[model samples]
Target chain A: MAQPLPPLSRRRLLRGLLAAAAVTALPSPGGLARAAEPLTRELPGTGEALPRVGLGSWITFNVGDDPVLREECTAVMAAFFAAGGRLIDSSPMYGSSQATIGHALERLEAVDRVYAADKVWTSSPAEGPAQIEASRQAWGVPRFDLLQVHNLLGWEGHLETLQAMKAAGEVRHLGITTSHGRRHEEVERIMRRVPLDCVQLTYNIVDREAESRLLPLARERGIGVIANRPFQRKRLIRRLAGKPLPPWAAEINTTTWAQFILKFIISHPAITCAIPATTRVDHVRENLAAAREPLPDDAMRRRMADHVRGL
Target chain B: MGGGAWWSYRPEDLLMFSPRVYARLFELHNQALWPAQLLALALGGMALVVLLRPGPRGTRLVAMLLAVAWAFVAWAFLWQRYAPIHWGIAYVIPLFGLQALLLVALGSLGGGLRLPGHWSVRRGLALGLFAYALALHPLTALATGRGLSGAEVIGLTPDPLAMATLGLAAAAEPARRAWLLLLIPVLWCLLSWLTLDTLGDRRAWLPLLAVIVALAARLWPRAPSPG
Candidate 1:
């Protein structure tokens, strides 16, 4: 009952395939050129290589009508794009964040350069379309690169709507999300039965419960995985503050404790990206820097996790 | 929501805005209300002056002024400013509206005649709270390393206004009526304390302290009203 897919959607799909082919032509993962370049991982469905570090707009970007804070948010976005970051994620539930991101995108004129991801969060199936449209208007984007049902709220109806949107080429990708270690069984069930481009869940140094099941499930399903709460909403970072970075952190090229923790999460083979929200331009750059070359290998990852566990 | 699910949420999880945004809301509110802030300060001063004498007319005047403040804040801050960012505030807005109506009823219907009078510990505590809401609340910005631009004015920002309400309600003629009037302000103070505390702001204590003082003012005896 839906119209045929649009030419723009077809072109984007072709572009993704070409980009994936280009990545395949690049040097081996361990080659010097690849190591020196910024870290990126391919989306399982589209083969689009998204930078492993994405911006999250939770408390960080919900500055409402405060011009000073809006300008500060814009600066953070500008820095994010300059650092080769893409895939800025937000939800309608976060007050004014969608508008804030729209404000920044309009000011920076980097809408075309960034990957816009937002969520549909409402209980009524009837309200889902209106809310998603409102979110797109708030972002000033023609379409969202990805849309998810937040926390599995109204997932049944919203997922059906998102599937139609994807089929109609109204959205590039569709998914579901949960955070703070919530509703995992439902999320796992959705991933098993329904097709999803990505599954976002809490996966930080301390909140590794996702590792036991969700991460492995994502890998098994060939689903792209986005790690949210990479800093456990900054509680982990605050706890690790003033603690020395491990001496061997030099091997993964980590300087600050933020980069050390971030690198540890991204180093996992299944993690497509980690969205760490920030209000500071310096912190955004520092977060992106975590995605750079010489990410910790399997053995180092174990040591890194154990060290933080002991700390 | 069943079982332990409710306990899993931390305070910060429910707080959508940062302290910076919260503080700036007051600053922007103060800026928009401009010279009106001086009028609000003057009303607070008037309430303090009238509380000292405690005549029937004075009691009604205090109630009338407080009613006006509740109406203004309900519209200006809660509805126009806060509800946009916090949909939860929409529910609180009607409570404020109800508070305004209650104060109006107390003032016009002579219910204020029941307000407590005479020099007692209750009266003294009331005076202290009224004076603090009027003069001291704004000065708190300085202690927090912020400028006057972000200062919360009486009747304009909720905290000081709530504190002042508790202060004025201390004199309610019928002790029962005093409790009725103190209900909203006391609840608002507790909610404010939780919000500020979650933001890690030290001033979170001010509302709690005000609540304690206001409670003492109501419950503490007044020298047996002297024969």
Candidate 2:
């Protein structure tokens, strides 16, 4: 026989707990600024000052069942902002990244300063609404700052909804994105026809296919460019492994292979920001260095490109 | 997974000049499990609540809760970028959390401990403490340096060794320390996850072996019986 318990709704307790957790998750004003501190490299966008370095949530923070890692990853995010960094990009396909961001940021309290960007990766009309809602819930924001169609995930009708979101002020920006090398031409074709504000794709030192058309076209269209995988899946590390750091690499304040790669990506005038995701505090520190100072000029960019290509 | 092996992964990695991810995401979520994904998280949360006990159950419950949300977030946002990585650990956290509440609910109406009103700062403190433990995990990974989305031993799967190590470390008062045993499973999940997923498939297999070692150690005979 068990003792009788008082009457109270467990759901209410959960809601209360969630609310409390959310409050706990929200960063302090200083902590929020601190979180964005590392990402303070502002890119000269169409008009607004955007952080030159941002975080990519494609794969780093998503470790199933490792809530500890998620929290650590969230701390890494806080550390990013603390280091003058800002601009984090995520999408629906990047499972639970949005949710993780919400969970982690809910307690931080000062999350408003941080750029909250995620995507809707869907195709069905109903699915689009649900995804946007889900992303909103996961992000814990009523509306998103930038709601993109993930990898061109739900390009047609969802973009239509995005257009509405932009019109109604539910979102500040709307666009389509892709990452495959072979999809460049197709990506280019769509960019030509679509009313887009931003473009994302892989454009690291070793993989320079985007430079041929997508990048140049972005400049022509006045689209703000965001670079991703500046390191090419850490291929640069694999490339530069066992090799000494270049003498000139340190000239731009690059200490590790991570900075060198990130610097190279943002060097191009067309790029607004380069988002490279990392879970380690050290890597975040290294990546933030790219946004701190001027990137290598075109001449240096060419030399770096050639250097890595040769490697 | 849609992207090529090179740098063709991650939604943010691509330029969305004329993006299509919106439509694609819609198609993906509408098919079947999208709605359930959120529910799974809820259920997983519930499981954690149910499984966590004041003595040994309390810590294990908390560990499971931490594992569930962490894994769900990881699968949703980072590692399984394209789809949900369905596994027992993934669902168990919330499942057990909810189950715990259910037991209390049934046990209470049918006769149990009286429930407390509004969660006070005490619960908040507990959460903060739990979050502290979660935050420390990456340090373990960072110390190892091999920590990444795919690093083994401390993922969704429970590493027996990690659990035992954690269990033994907290073994002074097995009741209060039993939850430490959960580290074994959490570490095991992390270790096994290394091979199953990673920043990319190209990551070295070192974490895989580490996870195996952790699991073996957990299975080793010991005084405390870690569930």
Candidate 3:
């Protein structure tokens, strides 16, 4: 049986209340020292200080009308926002993800904070604007923060619409996105010719193909780069599971492999943010923690890449 | 259209179709052909009734109904709809067509549907499975928190048809002949499981489990048929 302790003094009670408030005020920690101000990267064109970590809604948020799954996703989004995440990326190709996002955002009362990013992925040029409109309605947003041409699908036709939308203030920025290193040549051609504001492509420690050409070109063109598949869609993290983090991971202030890999991607000078999709609240906490501390320097980045490659 | 711009490709890009898109495809397919879905459901009910009352005429009717169901699902869902997003499904269309033809031949030539020699635990399990495929498969949406719009009905969708076929075949006797009927449904179960698993649908394992249970019931040693 437990025994009761001494009665609380007024001063001790006051101290306890103050400590409790402080603890409650601080963000939940999965890693890093404490809740530091989230690191931000400027959108090269607009100088908008977007958080270096964003959420992606690919397979993770496509729960379709599952109320339980939607509530779980809402909790995940709540954790993301509570940890200072901003950008939320989605594609119409991701099925019900946009609707799910809208639902979660409505419940969390987080619509205002969302830097909504979506894509147009249809083949018909005539259908491009309509697709964007449908996405807007699905998201329940009046305007999109970013609208990208998904995988360069009918990019030529869609670009014209995106440019008009940007000019008309319906979209804050316009860009193009591709993954799996597909069509880098085509993507490069579009970037060089079109006056675009951003480019998104897959860039993880293993899939370093983008570092060679796309990242450099985006840097050269002053185009903001959003890194997709930072964990190779969980392949990298799953591969590194149970493997110990390098002793030097402390230099980057990361405690988990998810943070280690996410830090590696966003550490690159060219990358503005890395949108890592996650369904779990704990993972969201871990991912958002990567943005709170100083990212690795170039040499550190190379060393981190080598460590994962060696693993 | 440009000299340097050829189509870009990636193996993972093939997996871009989300579970939402997969479910929405079924919803659209059902909605686009409304009354026909009712007719298909009616035919499935008839097949189950005929299968329970085993006779040569009833056997022929069940086979004919299954053949038509497979043919309709293949032409309507696989060839016409699923092929657009997944070009690889085009190759599967022929397999479905072949299954339909095989059923037609089996109905005309093979001995009438052989009911299990006697009631047993395996036979009871097979009946329960068949009833689940026919009745509960459509209510999966309710379980998954989806509306009726997303339901996949027996005889209307390939997964349920494959499931029901395995369940019915498990309940039938003459194990050697039942093996022939088992082939296509087993293949379909494996294929659908892989596709659904890729889409991150939890229901992916259902078909695979059905295959395993049916095979287990089939292999369960039966008491020697009474002379």
Candidate 4:
């Protein structure tokens, strides 16, 4: 007779279930292949590990009510989860994106696995709560896993509301986001004064303004840094289309230009995760592949930057 | 769709206006150009009356009104504003102007605008299409989630003008001459369908359906001319 099997721990059981789900979520043949065991980073405030690669819904997920396009978006989301992605960031400013995400979630049945991050984007203090409520409804989520003040719009008023919501368990974490390096001083001032769990801003190989101040400050303040525009909205990738990746990219296990650029962002010690939005499944697969082992070291990070700048 | 460096950007990114931004533009256009819209509505009303009771002078006037409307939209919307964001609009402006000039030339040489000699299923369908352009196209915004403020009215916006032109062409006599008039509007419909599809707007199929109905009316066997 076979020896009696040992009882599985709850953590191990959950992992097994997740592994099975990931396998089931794999794309059919002729679709992009899935990545395994995605890399993750710990949130400094809560010490919870989050996948280093996440999806942003700025323009990619704004498909409004077209069944064919929605199906394509569903495929993109399915591929995202299959690669162990969890965080999906959106905002009211990205019109219809939240609604589209809700539609995709309904179709994919992956709501429980999603780490929903949204933003309060209105300028009115009174309107902030209503906007947040609208975003929640659009996303079909009972509560947001992370809520941020988009571009620091009405930051003072919205930050207080986000904090209160977090305390009340309506939001898991409170944060603020900015992009294009706009209002960095004000963002830094807020970061210094407020006890934010996360601060999102644009940081790519070409745009490294965050490295001098925001990244260092986030590190000192124990705030998680979420990097946005990892590909600079496809500008960097487009600029380097004909150029071949340097042999050094192999050290970080990067193949495509997208991977090279994303690895550069996430390799930074300050960045907890980098959210890159794409409408194509192949692109999503390529993006998530950047989250695998052998991220660039400090010297390699510098080399990555220099390589792009030279190109 | 993929070729060269141009394919590097997604089709949606090429759109200068988001749906909200596009709606806001219509709002601002309507607000700033107030009573002008009322005047355009009056022209559309006149055109409908002429369409019902065909006459040479009334037909010429309707064609002139369409030409003026297309020219106005080309200047006011495409050339001045939309071109700033979408560089392709500069090329599109010329096409609108060309369509307007075609209408002007056709209106000046006046036999093609006469309605079909007899009433039939084909004629009724054509009339319905024209009526849809005038009476129903504006209301489509409601179903499309764009609201009444963003509605593209006939004799005011490019879409309804293109749509109404096809409807008018389908109802007119001499299939071969009408086919010449159908060319620009059909092209516009296809272009609009592609752009709207890229934006994921539900109304993307509207132009396509209009094209199909227009083609059916054009090809439908005409009731034998009255003896």
Candidate 5:
């Protein structure tokens, strides 16, 4: 016969542990910066300045236990940090990606430079806290700067736990995430109801469903917006590869297709960050370079959108 | 980008690793099991000989050899390696283990398999598949502009190993539970096909083609026994 086990839910168990441990500020091991300070946006209400460009570890960082691939990922992270980029987002669902990030940070010794962001992804409410804790252990962080309810799965329970964690200072901010223009209605509803510090959604130039409602709501609510899949996971870049960049793109100082797409996302007033995941060091540098000054104004933004749309 | 409908999700949408990572897995797996790859080929050769000729001792030997291959793949490739990168692989690892146990049971307990007594279309097709898995399949790496290190060797990688097992099962004369041996390998082939297809690799057709040939061989008429 199996035991029923303790009645304590994972959230409560985590809360108890949080109460016992002293919440210390994460150490900054700075001095990797080699570029001018990249453009940054303030996290809604917290006044925390986050680099407009962040590194995403989705398909790019899930490189198993292979030492070579792990080192390659570390090099990408090194380039990202060297360019004055800060926020690095990952999730439990990304399979070994968090561990890879931890490996990179450990190798680079730039944990201080990274604004660690992760997500709670399990549908089981009781499993949410444990997952977040495991992710924290994977990233080797004291606590994540932001923890989001991934794709709105079991958002009710995970959101409540995140709010509790935020109040307890276990996490600095709480938010929800959706990708590929998914579940916008529910995402918008949560933005209205919850005191979210940020919201992450798929907002590349092609997939702009969030523009009409979610982006506006995020701005109105003072919630920082993170634009994910800025290059549609490299599909958009591949699509625009052979096509010549519009001559007007030079007006915004965009030179490549990646810089064009990333600039369009970060230039939005509501978007606090654009996380473009990559496996190459050169690509990481190019992504961070897009965050430099001379961003696209409203007219240029429309022109950029139209140019890609026409292409 | 379709409205988050579960059905709307394509195979590529679920793939969390890149083709480069997938190729690297094989290269590293091949590197770790260096001399053992030669042993894997030897075992495959032994199985091929047994497949072409029908005898109780040889049949049992082939089954045991397949059992070894399945067990090794379950532990080394799927469990130790792939489970970390692709979390869903952990669930399928046990299926490989179960297939190994089934092969062991078939080898020890006997009577489930019925090998053809003489040359037939099925036997020829079986030999073809064995040859493909053991030899031709690995060359796909070189053909696709990848290094020999990423070759899908029989008994080492799942795709070729599954193809070889399906070949062995197809060569056997129809039996009550012999189809059990084909079940997991067949499913694995379909899955491999989906994964490769999702990656947009043309080699996706290789596994799918193996399935079609294996099934056809299974259904092919057995030659008449000696009078």
Candidate 6:
């Protein structure tokens, strides 16, 4: 008969075995693979196939004017498109990033392949329409694909205008966003009660709190989701330093850790796409590769979690 | 992290360091390296003078100079990455070779690096310099703050570079002897880097002194000194 064991040790042994099995059976490189024709998932009440990855304009295109900066933004847009990117997220709070994007779109002349997503960064419901209109005017896009109230800025009133814009065919989708782990319950309630097209929030390999609720809610509601701050502001960069990408990661075509982490974030069935903010053209291309392959299954996800956690 | 905090291109970066500072530093050096500074100057001076020595000593000095040269190169090139998060380790002394070598050279000349036959002074004077350098960082930062080159640091604080230089110099043998002669001043300049970048305010770094000392004691346990 097996000797009696303490309960804590038994739990530990089981967790260890489960982790081992998961790592051992990680899918070959084909995991984290995206569709051949730039696969996209449909937004709620909408049939459009959004590209599985977008670009967040937090620190990237936010720097206004500086002609050279505009040129670099254009290159990033071009590189983004080259890598099958479609959705680009921007907001007024980001200091003329939307305006800069408008400048870039005109220069690239490639707005046709883009999804314009901007947010109203104010709290007054009365000014909501004007704010949305300003963003629309700032970007010079005839109709925004999605308009969100950044960080729940306008609460219900901004959402009302976004809803109206959607109904009027002025905007394709009404979405909202929050970050730094705030407003999770609020985001969840919105997903549950209202009709929404997209939701943006921070989700990186380091912060998996969304895995418990928000991501699952998006799937249940059929709302498209976009991940922001997917890098945790370079923490992952330091964590992976001098460490080679796992051989198994090559199965998903990961040449670098950016693709590796992005793949991990987007691999979960709930994550419609991830919008990583990058200033470099090369970085955008690397980020785009996250959309390329089948995500690591539950087991590989655990391994990825373990790897980053230890680092 | 003298990556030195996100300056969106401010003119003050250049203007912040007044010409007076340069003049003052030169004057201070002329009056002679403060005890610690003198110690650093002696080691630095000896290292340079060794280049004029005959044969093997000169060759060794040349090798040491070349080694220090690469350290500076590595500081500027290979390890210049700044991502805010790693600022703790990145700005802490060895984060850059110019800073590290400067400390090491000073440390060797200071009294901390006493060899078996060399004189060893009590630690009081060096400790005082360490405390004074530690206190002056915020004052220096204030001077640089008047003009905004846009360097927005989360905060700045003194780091343990002085203590580290002292500990390392105290632990090496012939090298320790040379370093101890420079220790007081080396310790001061190393702490000076904290003012240059506040050095993480990573209080958790205290344990690092124990780690560095432990590593150095193991690696350079007192070797017999030659005359």
User: Each candidate's iRMS in angstroms?
Assistant: 3.5, 12.6, 7.8, 12.5, 1.4, 16.3
1 or 2, greater by lDDT: 1
| Candidate order, DockQ descending | 5, 1, 3, 4, 2, 6
Q: What C-alpha RMSD separates each model from the true structure?
A: 8.0, 17.4, 10.9, 14.2, 9.7, 20.3
> What C-alpha lDDT, on a 0 to 100 scale, does residue B42 get in candidate 6?
42
Q: Least accurate stretch of 10 residues (summed lDDT) in model 1 chain A?
A: A18-27
What ranges in model 1 sit over 4 Å off?
A1-37, B1-4, B221-223
A1-311, model 5: which lDDT tens digit per residue?
Answer: 99987899764564444323211111124623323468889998998999999999999999998888887787677667767779999998898999999987766666777899999999899999888899999998888999998899999999899988988999999899998888888898888998899999999888989889998999899999999989887789889999998888888888999999999999999999999999887788788888887999999889888888897
Error of 4 at B78 (Å): 16
Q: Give the TM-score of candidate 3.
A: 0.68
TM-score of each: 0.90, 0.56, 0.68, 0.60, 0.91, 0.53
- Cα-lDDT of candidate 3: 0.80
Candidate 4 Cα deviation (angstroms), residue A299:
0.7
What TM-score does the first chain of candidate 1 have? 0.88
Per-model lDDT: 0.85, 0.55, 0.80, 0.81, 0.85, 0.58
Please report the candidate that would top lDDT against the real structure. Answer: 5
Name the regions of candidate 5 deviating beyond 4 angstroms. A1-35
DockQ of each: 0.33, 0.04, 0.10, 0.05, 0.60, 0.02
Query: What is candidate 3's CAPRI-style docking category based on DockQ?
Result: incorrect
Tell how far residue B122 is off in model 1, in angstroms: 1.5
lDDT of 6 by residue, A46-93 (tens): 887777778887656654344556666777776776566789998866
Where model 6 places Cα greater than 4 Å from the true spot, the runs are A1-37, B1-227
Give a tens-digit lDDT track for model 1, residues B11-53. 9888888888888888898888899988888878877888887
Give the least accurate 10-residue stretch of model 6 chain A, judged by summed lDDT.
A18-27
Model 4 lDDT vs. the true structure?
0.81
Give the per-residue lDDT of model 1 (tens digit) for A235-302. 89999999998899999888998998899889899999999999987788788878887888989999
Judged by whole-model lDDT over C-alpha atoms, candidate 2 comes out at: 0.55
